[model samples]
Target: MDPTLFSSIDFYQLAKREKNAQKRIRLLALAHVKEGKPRDEIAESLKVSRSSVNNWVRRFRCDGLEGIGNKQRSGRPVYLQPQQEELLRNFIESHKLSSDLPPLKGKDIHAFLKHYFDIDYDISHVYRLLKKLKITL
Candidate 1:
C-alpha cells in the first residue's frame, strides 16, 4: 500500500483548500486513498462508494483537477406540479402560524396543501420543490 500524498496538503488541508465542494471532497478522498485508508473508511469519510474511489482515482489520473468535480447525474425527471408547488409557496408566505412547534416540516406542509387545496404531493417531492424555489430548510 502506498503512503504517498496525492496533493500538496494533507487530506484535511486539501479539503479546506479546494473551493468546489465536490472537488474538495474527492481530493480529500484521494488523499486518504493514497495514504492507504481502508475502502470502508474512505467511503464513509467521503460518503461515496469504494467503486467511486476507484473511479475518482481513474478520473484524477486521466483528467487531473477537471474530473474531481461532480458528474451530471442522469435519472428520470423528478417533478412537482408547478402550479400546486407555487400555491404551497404562496400559502407559506401568506400564512403566519404561531405554534409550540418547529418550523413546519415539508410533510406537514404537504399534508396541509393537500387537505386545504386538494393538491397531492409526496413529502419528498415537496422538499425537491422547495429546493427549486431556493428556500432553505
Candidate 2:
C-alpha cells in the first residue's frame, strides 16, 4: 500500500495533540508508515507487533484518519449521550476554581454526572470516562 495517503507532518501533529496513549501509538505508527519505513522496522521501533502496524496501515488506507478511531460494537448502550458529553465538557470548563469553590475532584464529577445526567458509573469508571473524553483529572 502507498503510505503517502497521510503525510508525515500531518500524522506528527495529530499524534502530538492526541491525549490517548493507544491512539497516539497508532498515529505514530502511521506516521512512520507514511515516511515509507518498513512495517516490521516501524513495529520494532514502536514496540508493537508487526501485524498491528499492518492493520493500522490498512485502516488508514481505507478510511484515512477516521479509520483509526474507536469503532462501534455490540454492547450496552452508553450511559452518557454525546449531547450530554458536550454539556459536561462545557460545565467543567465553566466551573473554574475560585476562592469560594475548590477544584473539582473525581467524586465531585461523579456526583455531577449522577445528579445531572441521572447516570451512575463506578468511581473507577469515572476516571476511564474522563480519559475517554480527553478531560484531565
Candidate 3:
C-alpha cells in the first residue's frame, strides 16, 4: 500500500466521531490499511468484502476524507416548504390557544392540509410532521 494513500492524522479520530456504523467500519478498515495490515486481513477482521474495502480506498484516494462518509440520498421531498410549515405550525398553536376551536387532531390536520395545500399526506406522516414542527397536539 502506498504511504501517501493515508492521511497523516489518525483515522481513528474520524471513526470515533462517526455517527454512521458502516462509515465507521470503513474508517477503521482504512486505519488498519494505513498501519500496514494486508487488505485481506483488514477485510476479514472487519467482516466486510475485500471489494468494499478496495472501493473505499479508491473513493478516499479520488475525493479524500469526505468521500468516506455517506452520500446524499434522493428520497421523498418535503410536502410543505419551510415558510408554509411555519405558517401551519403557527395556525395550530393559535388554534390551541383559542377556546372556540376544537382540539386539533391528526385527522383535522390531514383534512386542513388537503383543503388548503391540496396535499394529501398519510395520517402517520401528518403526525410525524406535527412532531417535527413541535406542535403538541
Candidate 4:
C-alpha cells in the first residue's frame, strides 16, 4: 500500500458531513486510502476509475475536501427576474379569483409575458414556470 495521502480521521469527518452521494463516496475512498488500502482496491470497491481515484487524491492534496465536491455550473439564466415572477404570480392569482376570466392556459401566460415584459418564452417553458410558481392547471 502507498503511504496515506491524508489523515483517515479528517477524511471520515468529511465523508460523514458530505451531502452529495458521489462526493461522499469519493471522501470514503480517500479515507480507505488513508487506512493503507491499495488504489486498485479502493477504485474497484467504489466502482470508479483508478484515474478518478488518483484525481480525487490529487484534488484533496491540493485543495482539501472542497475540491472533491461538485463544481458550480452555469445553467441558462432566468428570463424573468424575481420581481417579474412575483408580478406574474399576482396577475395569475387575481385572474383566477375573477369568475368572468376564462381558465388561463400556458399560451395565455406566454402572451402576457410577451406583451407586458417583452419576454418571449415557449409555451412549455411558460407552463414549467407556472408550475414552479404553484399555479394550478
The TM-score leader among the candidates is: 3
Candidate 4: C-alpha RMSD to true structure equals 4.5
**Clash pairs detected, candidate 4:** none
What lDDT score goes with residue 136 in model 3?
Answer: 84
Predicted candidate 4 versus true structure: per-residue lDDT over 20-134, tens digit per residue: 8999999899888887899999999999999999999888788776778888899999889999998998998899899998989888888999999999998889988888888
- lDDT for model 1, please: 0.72
Clashes of 3: 0
Model 2, range 73-127, lDDT digits (tens) per residue?
A: 8997789889999988887777763446778888989999999999888999889
lDDT, candidate 1, at 123:
82
Model 2 off-target regions past 4 Å? 1-5, 76-137
lDDT of 3: 0.88
Candidate 1 lDDT over 16-85, as tens digits, reads: 8778887887888878876778878898877888898888888877776566778788986644567766
Considering TM-score, which of the candidate structures 3 and 4 is the better prediction for this target? 3
Candidate 4 overall lDDT versus native: 0.86
When sorted by lDDT, best at the front, the candidate numbers are 3, 4, 2, 1
Candidate 1 minimal-lDDT segment of 10 residues: 1-10
Give candidate 4 misplaced runs (Cα > 4 Å): 1-5, 10-20, 31-51
Error of 3 at 119 (Å): 2.0
Screening candidate 3 with a backbone cut-off below 3 angstroms (N, C-alpha, C), the clashing residue pairs are: none
